[model samples]
Target: MFMFKNLKSDLPASIVVFFVALPLCLGIALASGAPLFSGLIAGIIGGIIVGGLSGSRVGVSGPAAGLAAIVLTAIGSLGGYENFLVAVVLGGIIQLVFGFLKAGIIGYYFPSSVIKGMLTGIGIIIILKQIPHFFGYDAEPEGADSFIEASGENTFSAIFNIFDNIAVGPTVVGLISLGILLLWSNVLVKKGKFFEVIQGPLVAVAVGIIFYVVTQTNDALAISPAHLVSVPVPDSFDSFLGQFSFPNFSAITNPAIWVTAFTIALVASLETLLCVEATDKLDPEKSVTPTNRELLAQGTGNIISGLIGGLPITQVIVRSSANIQSNAKTKMSAILHGFLLLISVILIPTLLNKIPLSVLAAILLIVGYKLAKPALFAKMYKLGWKQSIPFFVTVAGIVFTDLLVGIGLGLAVGIVVILLKSYQNSHFLHIEDNSNGKHKIKMSLAEEVTFFNKGAILKELDSLPRDTYLEFDVTKTRYLDYDIIEILEDFAFKAKERNIDIKLISKRGIVENPDSFIEFFKLRPKSKISLS
Candidate 1:
């Protein structure tokens, strides 16, 4: 009853997401060089099956733009689309294994900075990628996120190219659609439930269809078929069913198939886990998704999709964010959108095909703006270098490269920042009394000092002046690496020659004039050289 209770809100949001997803399914399938119908199958399976099985409340799964490159390459390298389906099924099984292994924890290892960077980067990329489509230059396939497009033109060059090739019809439709969305979101939707339930995107799409029909005979303003949502329209029900391609089990023994399978599994799992974390952050209720369960759900979705001829699937942030922005209260919104995709193909493919791609581009333009707002940059910078460095790098990386590479670059910077913090936090210095012409320095070790702290500890010990009195404190330390312990042990021996009296204080108690620290710490075996 509770799930159904949000049906009112969920139904409206589902309509928004369905419009957002339609062109993406066809474009990604086109980009992947697979049968256009396969993308729809994947979207249907992703929404219904994955939505049903997943633990995430708002995250949506479907054919991912990020995996388009891999799918394209695999389809060719594996010899054919049918053989590639074998990889998709195997990839899903691998994800299922990952779920059982509880490997979903790897998702949490990413720093908050990198995740934010990913969202922002994707946002900027969406804006950049859609500008050309908004102007009606549809050479670049929908959902193509890479800087270097499959069409030989890069993101920037593509934008410039749009000036020469822009179609007046789609551009006008795109502008009108964008204006309507802005008004609906900024004004009309707040006026009444009527506007809210009808949804801004749905209205924009409806107007776009009317615009297409009215200008059909006017060559200058008439929208070309190339600028529209090109959902494959089969002549008969049997022909539509015949579009679904099964995997070739005979290729199961092929090494290339296995390699492609593993690659897809690893990449898909990472993308899904990252999206899960992101969508959870975006969730208004702040609900933590059971990531392992998500992996299992994705695995199942991929298996079903592949068996019936679909590209690989992952939890896509674009659709998920759109769902959240649309105020979806539960996964029901996602499930319902899947049904819409299914039904639209079966019953209303003609009407659905008439909706301009530019209209959808306008919708995504808004989605992208929400993710990459200017204020987020200022906020990240205020957190200091530890956060800002990764955040900037991630944004730049995603803008110039692709999603995974950008995340990887940002993660690398985050790790370096962490290591630097660890080095500085190895120990604390306290200046006690400086009487008797011998400086007394009390060095308190940190909670957990690893080999990363070795150089800092060694430097401090080496800097001690002659006849200094050293108080080495390890009482608060829970774990000490052997490298740091050795530095201490060696320093304990050398202090005697330098007339630096050493007092070793640990959990066991104080050892005045102690010659060896290993005996007190008991962490490392006595070095044969130290004992000798």
Candidate 2:
């Protein structure tokens, strides 16, 4: 029902996303140390099944790079890839339980500043990671998001290493691919319907494949097979069917399998929620996705993906952003892209392999540029320190560490900012000179006075001059902390020594000579007492 609404936009957008997601699915599987086809299985299920069930119009689901390390370790710990499949199946079941339990509300609590930082940080990571690939340095797998790579080099070091080992053929293909993508986005799409119908990345891949074929005899111009898309090709229909691995259901009794399952469910759900939030922010239409439904959809997808020998899946930001930038208008684009991956891998694996990795890298570079534009930094900076600090910290943390750790650091900073503001706004103080020559000092409590305000309130009370008329205003206060009340009671005795005449204005009206602070407060109901 959510599909087929915008064929004109969705069709071409699907084609672009398909190309973008194809390599990522394979690359993430390669990174996870799983059979490569498992990634494709997750991609197909993510797009066709999850996309259909998801409430997100623009979100595209697939095997995630974020879970690569988890999967790799789980496979080894579980004794085999098949045992890991058992965990994936259990993980999906756990995710479904989480959806029913309404745990998706956690998605709503992430600070927007941190989410934006995440987008910008991932964009920067994309650009950094792809640079090596752009120059034909293919040591790291495609779609790897972490700073530290499986190849022992970090993101920056990988880029530096590229200088020493650049492949001319892939470089040429990459530059041409980048040029075509830019032209299509900036110029060709505006020129006519013909250009608009043909997506730039599609054309880039076609040309890259042609270039690779034409340059096979020329050593300098020939792009090696290692630098090309490498889908697992089946020799026959039986072999293609054999590629689909079933989970070892007997391993379901293993306790370690349950542990791995729960971990996958938790991590995958969090990633999906975060991606859903990020994608919704990026949507031009400002659509709100149903976070709970998204979890349910993902749960269903992971179950199917695991049962069929696929890696775990989550809503991936990279493909979703690509779909949005390509003008995708509905879930149809995501579904269609999944179908494209399925058809291409099954029908034309050899032809698909001909497309150079550099071309795909170029396409991702464009996506990365759009996400982490220089203008975004200026805009965030203009929002002032409260917003900008967390934003910058999130970006820096993600660049230096990893996504979850970066978000945690940013969230901690954001919480501190909130506490600081609360501390500053706990109460208001005012002083006025009466005609009789006595200074009248009024201290009005904030709507909710907490223990954090006790020090500030005490300092203000201590600074009151002798022989002053002091009024404690609590008329508008809602909930008063016991600590603050105790402070006020302790100050009463001190006020007498300073010759200060204290008036307590509360819900019960003004009391001229109150008994002991504790007795006065205890005798009157909390509602009847207003300090004004």
Top-scoring candidate (lDDT): 1
- Candidate 2 structure quality by residue, lDDT tens digits, 1-532: 5366588889999999998898899988888999999999999999999999999989999998888889989999998998999999889999999999998989989889999999999999999999999999998885546653666677888898998999999999999999999999899889999898789988998899999999999988998998998999999999999999988888888999999999999999999999999999999998999999999999999999999999999998999999999989999999999999999988999999998999999999999999999999999999999899999999999888988888889899999887887788888999887726678888888898787777788888889888889887777897777777777777887887888888888786788646566776673433333343
Query: Candidate 1's residue-wise lDDT over 1-532, tens digit each?
Result: 7779999889988899898888889888888899999999999999999999999898888999889889988888899999999999999999999999999999999999999999999999989989999999988885535563667777888899988999999999999999999999999988998987888998999999999999999998899899999988889989998999999999999999999999999999999999998898888999999999999999999999999998899999999999999999999999999999999999999998898889999999999999999999999999999999999999999998899999999999999999999999999988778859899999998888888988888888899889898888878887776777688778878888899988878767889887666666554463222210
Error of 1 at 176 (Å): 1.1
**Positional deviation of residue 143's Cα in model 1 after best superposition, in angstroms:** 3.3
Candidate whose TM-score is highest = 1
Model 1 lDDT at residue 394: 94
Q: Which stretches of candidate 1 lie over 4 Å from their true place?
A: 524-532
Judge candidate 1 at residue 324 and give its lDDT.
98
Q: Give the distance in Å from residue 97's predicted Cα in candidate 1 to where it truly belongs.
A: 0.7
Q: What range of 10 consecutive residues in model 1 has the weakest lDDT sum?
A: 523-532
lDDT of each: 0.90, 0.89
